[model samples]
Structure formats: C-alpha cells, structure tokens
Target: MWVRGVEWLAAAAADPRACTGDWDHGKGIALLEAGRLWDVLSVPDRLGLLTLDLLWRPGMSVPGPTLIDTAAGRVGFFLPPDPSAGWKGADLRYATKGAWVAVPPPYRPARFLEWLVPPDGTGTLHSPGALAGALRQADGALAVLAPLCGR
Candidate 1:
C-alpha cells in the first residue's frame, strides 16, 4: 500500500478512534493498494485497509518505516498519552494469555465508553462480564485466523 504523505498516512494509519478525527463528518482519504487508487471515507474505512496489511492479512511484512504524524501532532509508541497507550505500539505481548487481538490505542476510559454507549445513548456502560465476553470472542476469532496472522 502507498499513501500521499505524512498527514494522509497518519489519518490512514492511526488507530481509528485514537486519532480523534470527526469521521462522522465525512472526511475523505485517498489511498493506493496493489497499484489501484481509492478514496476511502473516514478513519474506520482506512483502518480496515491497514487491518488487512497489519492484522489478519497473510504475508510476511516487508520492513518499512513505522512512524506517522497525527492530528494530535507527531506521536509514536514511546510518547503514550497515557498508560493505556500500550496498544499503540507494534507488539501484543501485553495482551493476556497471548491471545492476540488488535487493541486500538483508545481502548481505555475516555474512548471505551464511546464504543459501548454511543454519545447520544443512555449513560449506562457495559458490565465487566460484557467486556470480557467480547474479548473472548475476539481471541477465539484470532485463534481460528492464526494462519492468516503470519506469526
């Protein structure tokens, strides 16, 4: 995959919710894959592309540059905004049971609730059991897709 420049790649590469872009407002990102061009909408849309390359897609990763500039300014694994920034890096060793999953950088308190109760929803949040159950499902999916993980 190839992108235009730092700003474009940052919006396309940063974890969907972590970059804090108002994707709902209809921002467009241009990208190229397999020599074809695409105008992707929203960070989540770009995330899906990156997910194939970085997460579940099968193929040995060719060495490439890792840093990307973001709307929050330039950032990398070492400058975690908080403790939960662990997922912002390239390793899954922090995940429990070695059951790898893509834990996006904003998976902590602030954005965690957004994933649960939408901004306009009732003030309630999902219970701990709900969170754990979801993780279990994800880990199970990862196990089934391990061959595609290129581990």
Candidate 2:
C-alpha cells in the first residue's frame, strides 16, 4: 500500500503543473518532488496537519517558507522524531503574523534528551532545572523571525 502511494506521489511530482493550482495543496505535491521516499513516508496524517513548504520544487515563489497563509488562517508544520514515549501530536515552534502551527503524528513534543543534543557538542552545559542557580550568566538578545515579503 505504501509503495503504491509513493509511486503516486512520484507521478504527481513528475508534472506538478498538471496538478491543482491550490497553493497549500501544491506544497504537498511539491514535497513529493523534492523529498526522499523515506522522508515523504514519514509524513503522518492528522485532522489538520500542514507540512512546511520547504522544498525547492516547482511553482513556489518562495522555496522554503516557515509559514503560509491559508483560507482558514496562517499555519505552520514540523515533524519531530520519536518512536517511544511519544504520543506524537501537533506542535507550534514559532508562529509569526498570527500563524497557527500545525503538526501531524510521528512529530510531537521533543523529549528533554533530544533537546540536549546540540551541534558541535562543545558548548557550555546548563544543567536541567538550573534556571536561578547559575553562578554567572550572560544577557540575552531579542531575536525575531522576519518573514520574507512577496514570497
């Protein structure tokens, strides 16, 4: 069954211009074009799951956008990896401009250990629950997500 679905997605990707013009749905069509079979296979179905249009496929004014404006409202999506101790539901990382983040199954709350795995692994370690116990601390800077215009 999965193989047949993959094959269908492959066929759709072969000629996206022939698919529906719906932008949001088009993202799925585009994903089939840019993503690997394993990645597409990882997609989970939920009541209102909307995957991020992050693939550099055809018909996209912006290849990889954090969010999109749909008929319902603004939305975003992500897939978190976890097999056990997981009741994978939807999640919202950072929704700007009133965008509501959506998540499918197999992608939910990231466990603490998963968050601990940092790149390079050379950064200073902050023990979990050491919020006010730190001897020294550095001031933080305000970071913001600036959406790309005309995307």
Candidate 3:
C-alpha cells in the first residue's frame, strides 16, 4: 500500500508519473527538487551509519527518512526545509533549492540508491539539533578510531 505522503512527493517530480513508470520498468529513480518539501544532508556512509546508530540509541528520538547511494558511498538525511547552517563541509553536502536528488521509491530499495530509513508518509523529518549532535559524535568516534585502524 503506497502511502499518501509518498504519492504526494512523487508528484513534485517533473514527470510525476515517471517514478512509478520507471519502477514498473525496473529503472526506479526520480529526480526531485530539494528545499521545497525538504532539504537533504549528504554525508559519508561511515559517518552516516554511526550517526544513525546514535539516533536510534535507547532514549534518543527516531530519525527521519534516509537514503544511501552505495555507488557514491554517501548517505542522505532528510530534514525540514531550510535547516540552519553549520552542517555543511567537504563531506557534508547540503542540497537546497534548485538542487535535484535522484530519489528512489519510498516503498523499497532501488539499484544505486536505497533507503536506509524510509519515510513514514507523514511529514516527519530529522531534527536538526539531534542530527547535528549525533554527527559530531560520529565524527569524533571516527577520529579516535582512525589511529587504531591506521587510516
């Protein structure tokens, strides 16, 4: 059952119906604009995985939908429109107005891009504060482990 929210999001594409059509034909990715419905923060997969772990830890709030581009070795986290600054860096890419993201079907995984956490249909998104904190922690963890790993 396709959620109504996902249906509405698909409509934002240039050819709204293309998402479904491509899915049926086995090419399931649609380019959608960012900053309208939400903004996305693209981070390295290692950091993303660690941040996700923190976000899902006991007592922490559940995060919003996230996408992983295995081919690019990056992860995308969906956040509310026009999120505050300080989350940008070489590894942290923010997609805002005029930027387009190759979004996979919300219901399931796609080829190059797959959902790490699928949207729940409601307009829920990651809390910037929580995400930022978790990201910082993840960064620190990596920094400490890098020496031991000889990377």
Measured with C-alpha atoms, the lDDT of residue 113 in candidate 2 is: 10
- lDDT (tens digit, per residue) of candidate 1 on 51-138: 3234222564321222222332221111101223223222222222212222122222222111111111121222223323433454
Which of 1 and 2 is ahead in lDDT?
1
Off by over 4 Å in 1: 1-117
> Per-prediction count of colliding residue pairs?
0, 0, 0
By lDDT: ranked, best first: 3, 1, 2
- The sequence of per-residue lDDT tens digits that candidate 3 reaches over residues 115-140 is 87877777778998889999999999
Please, what are the lDDT tens digits per residue for candidate 2 over residues 48-70? 12222123226733211122323
Q: Indicate the TM-score of model 2.
A: 0.19
Query: Whole-model lDDT, candidate 3?
Result: 0.82
Best by TM-score: 3
In model 3, which runs have C-alpha deviations exceeding 4 angstroms? none
* C-alpha RMSD of candidate 1: 17.0
Q: State the C-alpha lDDT per candidate.
A: 0.26, 0.23, 0.82
